[model samples]
Each structure stands twice: as structure tokens, then as C-alpha cells.
Target: MIQQYGSGEPVRLFTAGLHGDEWETTSRLLEQLSPPRTGTLLLMPKVSDNEYLSTLDRDYYTTYAPHLLRAIKTYRPTIYLELHSYSKESYAALTGDGRFERYGVPAYIDIEAGILMGSVSPRIRKDFFTPNDLCVSFEMPKGPNEQSLSVICSLLDVVKECWSRQGFVAYMSRHYPQQTAVAVKNYLRFYGHLY
Candidate 1:
């Protein structure tokens, strides 16, 4: 079973580590935990931690996806975001389309990159989402390129604010503080749209 938090009008579901090796994403999510009863953000961490021990390089798609599928079917959340880490690339959000959707929400590869470039700082040049749109996985910077603590906090704040106001029925990248803006850029790039 998975864990959850918050429970009000707008439900923000944040998850980490479908793939256990993706420690950066896991660390980040773990660090941001608030009390569950706040009824706002629902967090599910290490969804695949035990399964990954034997599976190795495999992500959550095989072992843990069924649980997620069931939850989405049951709860019907406003948005569902699965987080992961890639050491090589920058960051991305996964959409469900296959680079062919008209609305471009599902399987829309590099949608995050597109959104961030239009609304974020120039320092972040590259990022991509899986095209699923439901999830946002990211690649931490290599060497000295890591974002600052202030920047991370800012990004989280923007995500909370934007999701709260607009809801997830539609796609929109709202305003964020300058420091937090980079995480938005990174999230868009990392979550490119997967199933």
C-alpha cells in the first residue's frame, strides 16, 4: 500500500521513487513532507522501493503502476505527479501522448521544456517531460550546476500556488518567484508524458 496526505477541495498528489535508484527526487520529496491532516497535498514516497531492490534498473511501470492505476481510478485526483531522477539529462514531465496528441497533454514529450522556456529564466536551457503529463521527473544538474536551496523552495511554492488556483483539468504555467521559477522549468522538461 502507499501513503498519502491532505484532503480538501484541491488534491495535490506528489510521489517519488518509482525507481529506487532515483534518489535525488526521493530526497527532495521526503524533505518537503507536511502533516497529512492538512488536507491539501497527498504524498506517496518510495512507491517502488521494495520492488526495485530486485528489479534494479526498472522503474515503477511494471510493479507499481497497477496500484497507481487503481488509485487514479478511485480518487480521481486533480493531478497526479510521479517523480524520478535522471543523472544524465536535465529534467522532464511525462505526458500520456506519443508526440501526436492534438491537445498535447498526454504523451506530449518536452512539454515542460516548452512551458519553461516561455516563462522561466534563461539559465535553464534544456529540459523534457516523458509525455505522460501526469508525472514530473527531473535530472539534477551535473557538477556545479545544481540549483540553490532558495530556488528549490521557490519552485515548490509556485507549484502549490498554481495548482491550487487553476486546478489540473487544464494546462497552464502560472507566475512563480524568480528563484522558484527554475524548478518549474526543470519540472516541465523532466515530465514529458508517459502513460
Candidate 2:
């Protein structure tokens, strides 16, 4: 269900559970739902609730792509964060250049040229990102462990702070010291090894 919270400008939209088994990510996104200190927060625990409830994996577009579009259009969020997880093969696709160790990080924020949606068109990507706006996804590793929960919590907290404050790069670096140097420029993307 989509729960609307908070008030004012800079509306924030967070979605999780496009995939049926993504309980951890869905729960984490729900936990972050609070009346924002300085803006609005729109939380969608499962965009495709039927798929999630059935516990049967299906493509997101087949079920409820309209719900996702409505959430974006209604909120017009200044920051849009989609929560997802990565399998071994999918993880390798991004870090295959050998710069990042395999499964080294708990979560990541993919902004550029990464597939965040299950089966949406390219036009939908524009909903999550716009110039001078924050658009990113929190990627968890396959079968999230205990550390995964902590990572999701911390990242969401940091994202909340960044929404209200300026120069959050230093704050983020202090919390996740293993951050890459390029994180400052592309602060929207946060991960343990890759930026």
C-alpha cells in the first residue's frame, strides 16, 4: 500500500518489493516512513501487492505499473529512491571491471545506466531523476544478511538527512568510511566499494 506522510516541499518517494521475495528491502523502506522533518514522504511497501502477496515472482509491469506512476505523479518527489537487491550474476555485471570486490558492500545507489525497474519503459526512468533532484536506488545483495538490514537503515537515515541539509557528503563519509572518493561528486550513489 502507498502511505502518504509528512508535509511541505521536497516530497520524497520510496518504493520497495517489486519482487516477491524482497521482504528485507520492503520492510526497510517501510521502517523509514515518517513525517519528514522538512518535507513530505511517500512510502510504497509493495508496488505490486498481488505479486508480493502470492509469493509468486512475476514481472512488475504485468501487475501494477500504474500504481508506481501514480505515486510519482501525485507526490512529485524531489527525491525518489527505489529499493532493490542484486543477485550474484547481476552484481557481477556492474563491478566486473575488477575495481570492486565481489559482494563487498551491503547496499548501493545506482543512478546512471542501471536497471532499477523490473519491466518498465525508459520513460519511467525520468520520473525518478530530474536535474537538481535526487534519484537513486538502494541495492541489496542476494539473500540479505543481518548486516544488510543495518546498511539499509543507515543509508536511509543518511538519505533523510541529505534531503534537509546541505553538504551531506562529509556526513555520509564519516558514517561509511569505506566510501569511494568520487562519492562527493555523485553523492546520490552510495555503496561500500563502488560509488
Candidate 3:
């Protein structure tokens, strides 16, 4: 259910398979990850087998996965990265510049990495982690691909190297100014804080 690797502060939690349909792809991505050299990496390859529970729906997860809730409270992760998938049809809506957005937060397309990333809302963060913790979700197009896999690995490296809130923000701000802003706004809008 939950596998932990490495050790120390700034614990990072990676979860996949909150929804049954997307579990296969998400879990595969999780499998590719190696343990971090520093800090703890908590991997939950399958959060729930019930196709009904979704991270987007707060009540579904809260009601169906008490064990997950327990794990979060027990571990107190510094960063929670939820892996999910999207349909090809919805790709434009996610990455488009139009006002219509599926996730409420601005999504960015890393053309070279072939991944779409957005911040999970503060509502979800509040339910699972402290206000200062970083919570984000990465969506791929319904399958495991090399580019996305590499990007996810790179993310873990960043988390391991920059294991503090301030350090992580500085890294993002220096390299990914736009995405950093979107993430900050997404967190701040809903009683989320980074201190």
C-alpha cells in the first residue's frame, strides 16, 4: 500500500491510482522512480481500487480512504505529488490560454518533457497536508511515456536537493517563473501558505 525509502526531514509523498481507470498508468510511473538519496520518499502506488474515489472530489477520498488519511497524518509529508492522467480530448482545455480551465489553476505544457503540471487546490492540500507543504499533480495522456517519466524523475531530484519550502520555491522561481507563480496563486487562494 505504502512504501517508504531513504530517510530524514522534508518527507515527500508520491501517490497514484486514486481512480481505478487511471491507476495502471499512474502506478507504472511511480514504479520507475528510484529512492531519493536524501530525505524520505513515501510511495503509494494504489490509493484506492474503487473507481469512484477521486482527488478532485474531496468527499469521495475522505469517505472512502481513511487509511490514506491516516498515512498522511502519520507521515506528515513536506510535499505531496499526486499522479493522474487526462484524456487526449481534454489536452487543449488544460494547456490552452483560454479562460476555460479544467483544474482551476493554470496548467503548463513542457513541450520538451511532454508533461502537463498544475497545482492541486488548497482544499485538497488542507485535507491532506499542512498549509506550507507543496501539493501538485501531474497529468499525462493516459499512458506511460519516456519523456514524462524522465520529468517526474527530475522532479524527485529537485525535491531531494531542495527539501525545504523556501529552497524549493527559490529553485522554481529561478528556473520556472511562470509555473511558480501559478502554483503560489493556487495555494494562496485557498488558505494555503508557504513559510
In terms of TM-score, which candidate is strongest? 3
**TM agreement with the true structure for every prediction:** 0.49, 0.64, 0.78
In the range 1-195, model 1's lDDT, one tens digit per residue, is: 555655674555555565456644445554575544434666566555553431111333334455644555556555445444444333333232342233222232232222221111111111222132233332222221334333433444444443432332132333334423444444454333322
Sum up the clashes in candidate 2.
0
Runs of candidate 3 exceeding 4 Å displacement:
93-112, 190-195
Candidate 2 overall lDDT versus native: 0.54
Better of 1 and 2 by lDDT: 2
Candidate 3, 138: how far from true, in Å?
A: 1.6
Candidate 2 matches the true fold with a TM-score of 0.64
- Sort by lDDT, best first: what order? 3, 2, 1
- Each model's lDDT comes to 0.40, 0.54, 0.69
Model 2: per-residue Cα lDDT over 97-163, one tens digit each: 3322433221333322332222112244433445456655555666666766566666666666456
C-alpha lDDT (0 to 100) for residue 146 of candidate 1: 37
